[model samples]
Target: MSTGIPNVSPNLNLETKDLKTAPGVSLNENQSTVLRSILDLFAGKPSLPKLALWRDDATFTDPITVAQGRDRYAAQWYGLQQAFSEIERLHHEVTDAGNPILMDLKTRYVIKGINKEQTINSVVAVHLDSEGKVQKVEDKWDGKLPEGSIQNVSSLLDFARPMWWINYYIAWAFWIWSFAWETKKKMTADITAQAFRHLNAVTVPKLVSVPKNEEEDAKKGN
Candidate 1:
């Protein structure tokens, strides 16, 4: 079946670090297997399939918009395969912060149909269901253009051109708003935690019982 997506060359190089399961992140045997399979797929293992890692209702979100369903998510990868001639995983790190696992990766790839190669640094926050399938993947990447005098918008525009400028601006606005909101929430939580720590440290001594000698002295005076 032709997906209307361009086929990439098979000689893509993907260098990744050893996958480490995060501590304190509770994952069953099935979940662990799923996560390992996903890492292996991205690590350029030809035997591992990518589509099997995601659930039927999986959702993928990037800077542009959110794509729902496993097919839509798979389409996103198809787009990547079409766009990049050579993809390399510059760095990869996985951290488990309790529930969901966080994967941070830096990638550099040569854009197909364009003469210049580009680099993208991205962080993917993955959520898994009980059965170990990927339920949601939230990806945030630095989409800044590469540093060079040569500008090639024609090739990209030929592929996927924006219908309207309004949609582009709206996507940027939503991204900025979401980033600010998350930053504000994190700061507020940190401030609240600091206040509680300070209050406990200062007030805890007063709540403690008086010293034994002082109490006895006061009792004698009474």
Candidate 2:
């Protein structure tokens, strides 16, 4: 059952601001649970500020310092909490129905004050692990504004924010995404076909050891 992957403890000193540390990023049960709690807390309310680690240097270390445990976790949690401040709901759907490579389309509602809403769309490529956990998560976004959407919602906001092509980045992003996708599809199809041809040559034959008698078969069954 072992994957033969060495258990190299991750550097705990990563800036904690620019990334999300999903719980169970490591295989260790205790570490995984604690990481999950931190992720859950930030995802749930995001307002809770102080984060703490229950272990000391004997339990956790990256090389340089010893006092960087709970504080590091707290910093990362805060960053994640801030990153999603503008979003309300994130929706995802699969594109390739038969494949695990999901076409995640996300529609985020931009928060307008306390209750108002604006729409921003995004796409992502997601890959899951054998355990049904997210093995990889890649975010895609267009910095451009939606076509005509900005014009439609123009009256809602103050006149200070001018119409820049920067608003058009979202639309441009979608265009770029389509192009990239088509190229990937062609390249992947070609690579897969080539790989399939090697399957027969590279596969090892199975060696089945048959039971010698009914008693042995019964023992094996047991």
Candidate 3:
């Protein structure tokens, strides 16, 4: 059975046959066949090692920072992997959306995670080298709360529960607001229907009511 675990560079062995084809405006049949073979080898393979080789030590190229060293690339790769794992979890959820994910349109990843009404959104930027290896991966985090909700309480809450009173309060507050908004909408619709019914019931004669008093005699002076 193929283990779902990502094949890290330490275990994967790259062969010359695994090299990617040269991208261009056009390629002859010979090139196409060679490229196909190369693609078949590299397409599904992990390229973590290639990414480790290209990272700049001083720059925070990814969401997490890594120190400069012989092993710095490995450290950076691990950081990126962590971020990617987080994103994977998010994409598993279906309720959240609108995540931006790409420098080139060719590669894209979107993530959305929902716990009750709370949602976590993340956009990941990824780059691939000519060898079809992962060159870079970056991540940004976003928290989306229900309407009229504050961040204080929501931020304190754990994955499943919050020890803070404010978290509970906010949860209840959102629930009430959501309920009230729906109730108000329904009430408005009902009231409008009732008003329409009353208007429909009024006849032409009823609408033309006789004047009660005022100038009763002056108006008839003719």
Candidate 4:
């Protein structure tokens, strides 16, 4: 899924046949298929095939926006295509985490109009529902200009140079924000689980029936 950030690299279209699965990762048949489809989608394949893997109420989240619904997720691609001149995947590492598959990617690309090139290291976590359709996706990344690139600060005069400082600040802010949000989200989930555990641990007293004529029964027995 696209991050909805302007001037960012267009998403790649990776082929299943081209990917080499990481060592010691075991994936079920369904998960393997989904993983392949996800790679293809990122490589810039037609949206229809990618969308088919997602549920109608699927959500895509990144630093910029939390897009809910398949339609919104699909729209981000259009913006990305218009913003970047070309996108290339440099390296990738895939991890199979059962229901939620994780992919770490390094990518490089050139922005349109300005011809500025950038590299990004990003991780995408995709969650699949019980039916094997994508339910949610979380994307996180850090971007930088490659060393010795024309866009490097030393290449341009101070006044004409790109305001890289601003970009640095923004990236840092996003990192902190994402960290805090994830922390809070995990904490909340933990608290909820603890609450349920406490509730389940509570002991209930069993009821005992009282005999109305205990004395009479004892006398009759005697």
Decreasing TM-score order of the candidates = 4, 1, 2, 3
Against the unseen true structure, what C-alpha lDDT does each candidate score?
0.46, 0.29, 0.28, 0.50
- Which residue pairs collide in model 4, if any? 12-42, 12-43, 12-44, 13-43, 13-44, 14-43
- Candidate 1 TM-score, C-alpha based: 0.49
By summed lDDT, the worst window of 10 consecutive residues in model 1 runs over 1-10
Candidate 2 vs candidate 4: which has greater TM-score? 4
In terms of TM-score, the best-performing candidate is 4
Candidate 1 residue-wise lDDT at 45: 37
- In the range 1-222, model 2's lDDT, one tens digit per residue, is 121222322322212122232333223332333333333332322222112223211111111111123333233223323223454435433343222342334344322223334343444343334443333323344321111111222233224235423354443332223323332334244333333222211111111122344454345331
lDDT of 4: 0.50
- Steric clashes per prediction: 0, 9, 0, 6
Q: Write the per-residue lDDT of candidate 4 for residues 113-187, one digit (tens) a residue.
A: 656666667777889886777898776654211112112222332453356344444433332333334323342
Candidate 2 regions exceeding 4 Å error are: 1-78, 84-86, 97-100, 109-119, 142-222
Error of 3 at 123 (Å): 1.0
Clashing pairs in model 1, backbone N/Cα/C closer than 3 A? none
Clashing pairs in 3: none
Pitting candidate 1 against candidate 2, the one with the higher lDDT is: 1
